[model samples]
Target: MTPPLAVDIDGTLTDSNRALDPRVLDPIREWPEPVVVATGKALPYPVGLCEFLGIPVRVIAENGGAVYLADDDELEFHGDREAAQRVVEEYRELGHEVGYGKVDFTNRWRETELAVNLDQPLEPLKELAAAHGMHVFDTGYAYHVTSPGVDKGEGLRAVCDRLGVGIEEFAVVGDSENDAAAFELAGTAVAVANADETAKAAADHVTEGSYGDGFLEALDSLRDA
Candidate 1:
């Protein structure tokens, strides 16, 4: 049986500019594991990447805030609708320029969460977040904003609740301040060497190396553990 696998995208799966490393992809292609790509990128992005990897049907996108389960052999949506709306409402009230995510008929989640793209500057974004009593930080090419207390950790916990699994039953890998909280709860938390200092500090362990090279190394550790 495939041991359950939960991997992160962005800096974890790809390099700094959203580039995929064939070296890492090779191992994952043959990995005897249930791989899930968790990231802040909503449908079409990670979804398409997972498909290219020939592993579709399941993905935890938009950070841990959304989950996609293939419908009729094709993915359409993530988890609860009500919860997503509630969270979006809270985020908007916090003054973020939030927008609902509805890719190919999936609305289980309804917010962009953050704008981490090559089209914007970070300073103004930080000032805006500061003025609104929120926080904005970068994760490679994306920016994250949430009321003083919400993020991937909260979403990961929701995943645990939905799955009826304990924190110790899973492993998580990522590379940013956003990834810190969830790392605390995982059975094994790994940060790639190229990760920001904050992520490395919070990590239960650091990946043996950088990005793609390091991810493959970390997976071996999880399989061994």
Candidate 2:
């Protein structure tokens, strides 16, 4: 039997320009095993994507801060939002906005972590998060400030426990630093050609194709395995 799939969005499922590649829709929708959309994006995006794709709404969002399982209609939050918020507030005091404008919808509905625009300076932000007992992970799209002990691997473990599956029984695909943890836990970890060094180092396989094409390649390999 095919293992359940946990996939990232952004650089993994999108084109170079970060637009969702329409080609990935059918395969993911038709996947026989459980498909979990794990992303550094906020909860709503993945949940809405699953709804649109006609799949169960299983997601690990905010890097690992929030998890939702459709079977029990359960939404669990594991990160310390107040700690993250404090870090963001300090960042703001340092004369840097979260990079999104006043009406920043990017973080409007986010419950556990803070997403900072890539344009903002990263080093200081990382320092600020660390000072607050949080960590910053760059997903190639944004800088996510999350509480300690929360990451994609831990999120996948949580999902697996709830699904009655082992963490080693999943196939994970991703392209950035935020994905490295999940890659370490998955039985088969695939990194797309566009993956960063961290992700590639943790993956068992690296696809030649980039973006959505890489994702498709990984999917085909899983189906054949």
Candidate 3:
């Protein structure tokens, strides 16, 4: 039997322009096993994606700050939101723009962490998060400030427990550092051709294709396995 799939959204399922590639929809919807949409994006994005894709609403959002399973209608939050918010506030006080400007929706719906635009200086942000006992993850698209124990691996473990599946019974795919934890827990970890170095290093296999094509390639490999 093919292992269940846990896949990232941005660099993994999107095109170079960061738009969702329609190509991945049918295959994911048709997959026999459960498919989890794991991403550094906010909870609503992945949840809505699952609804639109006609798949189970299983997701690890905010880089693992949040986990939701539709089967049981469960939603769990793991990160320290207050601490993350404080870091962002301090960053703003330092005269550094969060990058998303005022009235930023990128963080409006975020409940457990802060997602800052990539244009901001990473080092200072990292330092601030660290000072608050939080961690900053660069997902290649944004800088995510989350609690130390909150990560995709732990989120996946939570989902697995609810589903009665082992942590090693999933095949995970991603293209950034935020996905590394899930890679470590997966039985097979796949990275796209455009994957960041950190992601490639953790992956068991690197696809020759990029973006959604790479995701399709990974799915094919799983089917063949």
- Best candidate, lDDT: 2
Candidate 1 per-residue lDDT over residues 4-93, each given as its tens digit: 556777788877566887778767777675556667666566678778888754566655545664532433333333443444355455
Which sequence of candidate numbers ranks them by TM-score, best first? 3, 2, 1
The lDDT values for all models are 0.64, 0.93, 0.92
Encode model 3's per-residue lDDT on 115-198: one tens digit a residue: 889898999999999899999998889999999988999999999999999989999999998888899988999999999999
How does each model score on TM-score?
A: 0.72, 0.98, 0.98
Task: Give the CA lDDT, 0 to 100, for residue 158 in model 1.
Answer: 56
Query: Candidates sorted by lDDT, descending order?
Result: 2, 3, 1
What's the lDDT of the predicted structure labeled candidate 1? 0.64
Q: How accurate is candidate 2 locally (lDDT)?
A: 0.93
Clashing residue pairs in candidate 2 (N, C-alpha, C atoms within 3 angstroms): none
For model 2, the stretches where C-alpha displacement exceeds 4 angstroms are none
Give candidate 1 regions above 4 Å deviation: 1-3, 71-110, 116-123, 147-149
